[model samples]
Target chain A: SQKIEQNSEALNIQEGKTATLTCNYTNYSPAYLQWYRQDPGRGPVFLLLIRENEKEKRKERLKVTFDTTLKQSLFHITASQPADSATYLCAPSRGSARQLTFGSGTQLTVLP
Target chain B: GAGVSQSPSNKVTEKGKDVELRCDPISGHTALYWYRQRLGQGLEFLIYFQGNSAPDKSGLPSDRFSAERTGESVSTLTIQRTQQEDSAVYLCASSVSGDPSNQPQHFGDGTRLSIL
Candidate 1:
């Protein structure tokens, strides 16, 4: 079966430090991968998306790197702040349609 | 300008009873989806609707779960004889089209359903 795994533990970092999250998947070749930010009791908010052919994508201080060979992706937030604390989710789509299979998110807490 | 909207931000119901959740997609969106999020779990795909094509119901957990969409507009998901395990946040999302390559989904504040 297709499976996606993310860090189950919460990631804590001091203010201005860099926060890195990882997502790994097995038994699937997704065409695109997306990242989302979800706060407690709220739905996920879209963050950034990286395609299979693309090795890396960046938005502001956030960056996403897709390594299809490794079936893994890394999300980074440079200069992280307390406000950046939230659960980050990664979803991958296999076909042209946006039917996504999401992995359990990794919670990041940036202390002030 | 409006995002996807789901009704009854929270619902509490008894087991063995039926419940209906509603979702209003963006005005021009042609694709709608239903998902369930259990506590401490990731989103689980329930169903998908696109234009007038037959819905992809493969994700539904059982016969107790069914959904209906009026064209590209409103969608309703009904759970019959709900079980305690049915408790979860039911989410609705919509994109410009069913072609996943063309658009990203916009989610609404979910309807949290609690079965007692």
Candidate 2:
């Protein structure tokens, strides 16, 4: 079965701690992957993009790692704040510039 | 605003009625897309447009759903004989280019459609 999914549906962590979310794919290898953050009642916001050739990408306190061999991507938020609570979606797509599908996402809560 | 814009943020209509939702993507963006997000579910792609043309309409759920873009800027999604099952947030997004490898999509707040 061809699928890209986040391992967890929801996760809770203490503020200032490091939060990690995982996305795994089967039966396919995507050339790149992107992560988005969505708040309730609002559209998703673009966060980061990682290519397969690259092992990891980082911006600010966020880091994303892509492993083609394992077909998995890990998104990390260091120094997480309560404001960081939101659903994070992962989109792994082929080189095509057409429609892009996304995983259901993992809702993260940073408790102060 | 410099971001994508969607009008009639909320709409309530009786089932079987025809409805139209409009989207104004950021100026200079040539790649536009529409998606449906049901409560507690992930977004489902509805359609994709590059400039004034749509290369992929396969994601559209049915003939009842139709969309058009003009001037490569504003797009409208019209659903005829709307059903209760169509109650969902309709989202619109646009990118500087069609390639996801290089561009990130900027999304609007979405239109919340309620079928009575």
Candidate 3:
């Protein structure tokens, strides 16, 4: 079976700093990977999607990089704020229109 | 204009009781998915619906779980004789169809089920 691995430790970063989270997959090579932000008591909201071919994707202060060679994807949030404090999840999927396989996720707290 | 909407944001029931969770996907979204997230755990895919038929149900945890969708619109997930372990937040998501791989999913806030 396929599995995803993310940073197990909670991350605490000061405001305005860059926060980077990692997602690694094993036993499968997906066509693309997605990142989502989830706050307490709420479902996850889509953030960015980076394909194996594209290598990198950016949206405002968020940037996602996909390294197929390492079967890993990195999600970066620039100019982080306290509002950015939440759990970040990564999903790796293939076959165009299919269900996503999500990682356990890393909880990041951006301190003010 | 609306995102996915799940009814009964919170559900509390006694063990062995049945519960139904509803999801209304975004208008015109052909793909709908259901997932479960236990406390401190990641999302677990429960089922996937394309239009009204399910193409993948491999993630359903047990025979006690079943789901149905009506013409790319509303979906209902029912748990029969649920156990205490069935307590978790049930989330619904929808996405547009087309591309071979890169479509983002819009998720609902989820229905929190507590089995006592």
iRMS values for every prediction: 1.8, 1.3, 2.0
Best by DockQ: 2
Name the regions of candidate 2 deviating beyond 4 angstroms: none
The digit string of per-residue lDDT tens for model 1 on A1-112 reads 9899999798999999999999999998888899999998888888998999999999999999999999999999999989999999999777675477789999999999
Kindly report the fnat of each predicted structure, to 2 decimals: 0.53, 0.68, 0.75
- Per-residue alpha-carbon lDDT of candidate 3 for residues A16-91, written as tens digits (9 for 90 to 100): 9999999999998899888999999998999888877998889999999998889999999999999999999999
Give per-residue lDDT, candidate 3, residue A31.
90
- Angstrom error of the Cα, residue A61, model 2: value is 0.4
CAPRI quality of model 3: medium
Cα error, candidate 1, residue B113 (Å): 0.6
lDDT (C-alpha) at residue A3 in model 2:
86
Model 2, B34-82: lDDT tens digits are: 9999998889999988875644788899999999999778999999999
In the range B1-116, model 3's lDDT, one tens digit per residue, is 57899998999999999999999999998988899999999999999888645458899999999999988789999999989999999999998865425788899999999999
For model 1, the stretches where C-alpha displacement exceeds 4 angstroms are none
DockQ of each: 0.63, 0.75, 0.70
List the candidates' TM-scores in order: 0.97, 0.97, 0.96
